[model samples]
Target: MIWILSIMMIIGIIIFLDTWRGIQTVLPLSAVEPLANDEKVSVIIAARNEEKSVEMTMLSLLNQTHSELELIVVNDRSTDATGLIINKLARRHERMVPIHIETLPSGWLGKNHALYKGYQVASGSFLLFADADIHFEKDTISKALTYMKAQTVDHVTIAPDLQAKGFWLQAFISYFLYGFSVFKRPWTANHDHSRKGGMGIGAFNLIKRDVYEQIGTHEGIKNRPDDDLKLGQVIKQNGYKQRFLSGVNQLWVEWYPSLKEAIKGLEKNTFAGFNYSLAVTVFAITTILISHFLPIFTLFSTDYAVQLLSAIFLIIFLALYGVTIVKMSSYSLWKLVVYPITTTIFLYSTIRAVALTYIKGGIEWRGTFYSLKELRGKQHQ
Candidate 1:
């Protein structure tokens, strides 16, 4: 009983700290700049098998209110009509260019190589490495540039507004976002000058051309799954300033269509996030269960003090999750009740990611199989 209470207190403290940090750190999006900056901005998109969404993403980006812009779409060997769509769009839009990648080198991961290829030909003072599925509002780039200009940072990663349709999807995202805030502690990414903590997002990672070139770009993080995160680490390690902001109204992405897809989607990178170590995965799952899921069951305990404490902790946890939910999506506090389901599902996915990696001896993503040894090797700084 004492041990359980101790854990409960720790969990409550963490929730309080995480919520406070999020409220303090997440920046708000502003209106579109009435006047565009003269500095040329190059937007890079590395796409593969994104047939259904690539066209819309490209159109949104091309229609940005920013005047001096170059959009480079790298067709990373998509089996669908991604290449054809890029070609068609490039023909119509003078600023859009398409680069088809027919082959990938031995040491490079698909997305990393594709981004690197796009970077090679990019000619702009600033570079925006955005995802193919993300749809940017006309003012996203404008607002990003404005924010960058206002601050002394060299790189900015925006946590885009997530577009989740169904209830389960929203609930899942609520838990995911809260957990990320608690664990990732994005606020510290910029505050810590030790060059160790970094934060980045695929939705909108804008960097100056000089800073990117100095850090070796994607070449430094080749063959890694979470290239966005590693890029932040590299930038910070190189002693460059980076900022994270909220893009609720400026940018959005349809993260996953269904619950099953969401689970499967997490399988690729969840364990990889733990550096492919079974020990870390096990420890993580255990901690998650104890610190997050266990509180609910304690509410039914006959011990009055335990029940009271459990209820208090649960309320605090829901409140913390609600703060992040409001930040990430259009969901309300009502959805916070399903956080346990979200944590359970995420734990299953993490275990599945580990099992798949060990059983297949490698991880398969977008028609490419990366060996476990290779992935483990690249996990180090």
Candidate 2:
């Protein structure tokens, strides 16, 4: 009992410190001034069945205050009307370059291959890799470029404002963000000396064109489903300058529309995040279960000291939740009351990800199957 409490206390303190550093260090995009520069920027978006939101995303980029920007939208063999929409938009706007890929290349994920193709045709001093569904404010690009030049960073990744519609979906997202911020320590990426911390968002990964090519580009992380994160890892490992920002109002994306979709969406990355190691996955589940779930049961213990300690640990946990929701999201702090339930849902999603991947022998992403053997082979590459 004492050992359990001790470990819980340690985890609680670590989370507190990590959450504090993240909230304190991650600056909002609005805080930066919009830069007026003549440097050409290429915005690359890989679309696979993104017909619904791709037009909106393209229009937002077209309306950016940054005049020296080109839009390269890749239609990654979408079975839907995504390609038609891209072609229509491209016809209407000369700055929009549309690429249609009929088939994914051998040994490459669809999106990654699409992005590499976009890069090949990109004639810009800077490249911004963004998702097809992301919407940007008029000044978002200009402000991002300003911050990059101001910080002298070669890579910049901004965390967008996640637009989850329902209560449970919002709660899950809130918990997911909290866990990611606490464990990943994204703020550490801003520290020039820290090789252990870095970040990249699929919605917004802005990097100098030379640096992107220098790191081997998407070809380096071709098979990774978590390509955005691995991109950041490779950048930091190579000792490049990187920065992270809070794009809360400046950029927005509907990560997943519902709880069911969110769970299904995470299936691609959650197991890969643990390197597909069942042992690592199990250890993470056990640790989270003990640190988060056990406290509730401990609160009913006969020993008053044990109950008090459990209560304190839970308080720290809730405080972390509150801070994460209030700072990283626009959700009300009152949502922290459901942290326990959301934590359970997160655990279920992680477990389901591992189970489904193993049961199917691989993951099916964007209508493609990547075998576990190939995925593990490309784990650290």
Candidate 3:
């Protein structure tokens, strides 16, 4: 019992300190000065069955305050009206270029291959890779360029504001952000001297054309489901300067419409995040059980000493979670009331991802099935 209490305290202290560091280190996109310059930035977006949000996303890019901008929107073999929408927008707007992919090549994911195709024809000095569904403020590109130029960093990835419609979804998103901040330590990515800390957000990843090509571009990480994160890792591994930013009001993405969709959405990357290692997955599950669930269960212990320690651990846990909710998300602190419920759902999601991947021998993403053997073969940072 004494040893368990000590471990809980240690975990609490580490999470608290790390969460504080992340809050302090991540810069707000709104605070940066918006630069209106002549440097052309080619914005690349890969869309598959995103007809609902692609137009709004494209319109947001077209209306950027920065005058010199190009949009390369790729239609990755969508069975729906995504291709038609892109073509219609391209016809009306000369700045927007549309590319249609009829088939995905071997040894590559659909979205990744589509992005690589977009990059091949991009003529800008700076390249910005974004999701098809992400909406941006008018000055988002200008402000991002300002920060990149001011800092002289080779790559910049901004964590966008995750928009959720319901209370439960908000709770789950808040908890996800908290876990990501605490475990990933994203603020460390800003540390110029460390290669261990690197991050990439799919919503907004801006890189110099030369830097992107120098890192072998998407050709190197074609099979990686988490291409955004791997892009940042390769940048860091190759000794390029990288920075992470907060895009609270500047960039927004409704990650999933409901809890069911959210769970389905995470199926592709959750197992891949652990590098498809069963040992690592089991270890992560064990750690989560002890750190998150143990405290709640121990609160009902008959021993007074155990109860006190558990209560202290819960306080620290809530404090870390509250800081993330307040700083990184638009949700109120009241959402912390659902911490236990959300944490359970998160654990379940992780387990489900692992189970389904092994059972199916692969992951189904964007209506395409990628084998685990191929994914593991290309799992190099």
Candidate 4:
């Protein structure tokens, strides 16, 4: 028991250190200077039933510091007032151009198709594919453009400051992001070119127009459910320079309203991210449980040495989570006290994702269903 606990502690410490190192590599947008070039930038958004958030997202883009910018929003066959809201906004703001999609074509996901349509008409030197739920601060785009120019990189993605409400939701995001940092390792996205290690945040993916054209644009990743990450991977795999930035004070988005909503929200991507592999899904659930929950429970064991080691491991684990929360702009330190609850919720969600995938026989997104066979055999762009 003692040996097993010691090995777990060692593995925990190694992952903690590696995650901290990766967090440090994500440069904040505040450190970047304003753009010096007068290049034209096109901001593309794919909206489907985003009536509640589209206005704010559109207005944020309109308020950018950069003058040479165009906002192209493709309404992806919305059933609500999304198109009406966009049209009203477009009439008021010259920069906002709304394209209504009456129907979705074959051989493409809804959002990916919308993005592709927008990309075809984009006449900018730089293109930024942003989600309608994302709220950008005044200088966010300017800072991103400047950073790209300074780093001499063709592609860049900014991890948004996630706004997760309630205790369970906050903790879930913290654990989820910690795992993302450990596995995706956003730090190595630019530094290591030998491996395809780039990360693309759904909130923002800014790329050079020519680079997008070179990589075959959205057509390359048209069928991929995890388009943002896949696009970044394609960029890295193609020998292009790409960087991931921290969007602490610059870009923001409300990830989910509650813990239940998050669990359902991530169900599709969780299984899809693992390429619909049952083995990988099981491995992920096991990994989350052993890494997070095991140490805390082991602290209450009879052996004094085991308890002491468990306590040490738990503290290190909290520290690792703390770094992740701070980097993600999650200021609720009190949530750490109830870390065990969040850990349990995260584990449950992982299992739920797997079960949901099996029960539904496929992934359902935006009223579209994709089978397990289709997801497993998904071709990379």
Give all TM-scores, in the order shown: 0.95, 0.98, 0.98, 0.95
Give stretches of model 3 more than 4 Å off: none
Reference-based lDDT, residue 122, model 4: 88
Predicted candidate 2 versus true structure: per-residue lDDT over 200-287, tens digit per residue? 9899999999999898999999999999988998899889999988999899999998999999999998987887789988988888
Per-residue error for 381 in candidate 3, Å, reads 3.6
lDDT of 3 at 137: 97
List model 3 lDDT by residue over 83-134, tens digit each.
9999999999999999999999999999899999999999999999999999
Indicate which candidate wins on lDDT.
3
Which is better, 1 or 2, measured by TM-score? 2
Off by more than 4 A, model 1: 31-35, 192-194
State the number of backbone clashes in model 4: 0
The residue pairs found clashing in candidate 3 are: none
lDDT of 1 by residue, 161-245 (tens): 8878888887888788887787777665556456767788888899999999998889888878888977887888888999888
Task: Give the residue spans of candidate 2 off by over 4 A.
Answer: 379-381
Which residue window of length 10 is worst by lDDT in model 2? 372-381
Predicted structure 2: lDDT: 0.90
Backbone clashes in candidate 2 total 0
* Each prediction's RMSD to truth: 1.7, 1.1, 1.1, 1.7
| Clashes found in each candidate (C-alpha, N, C closer than 3 A) | 0, 0, 0, 0
Clashing pairs in 1: none
Instruction: List the candidate numbers ranked by lDDT, top first.
Output: 3, 2, 4, 1
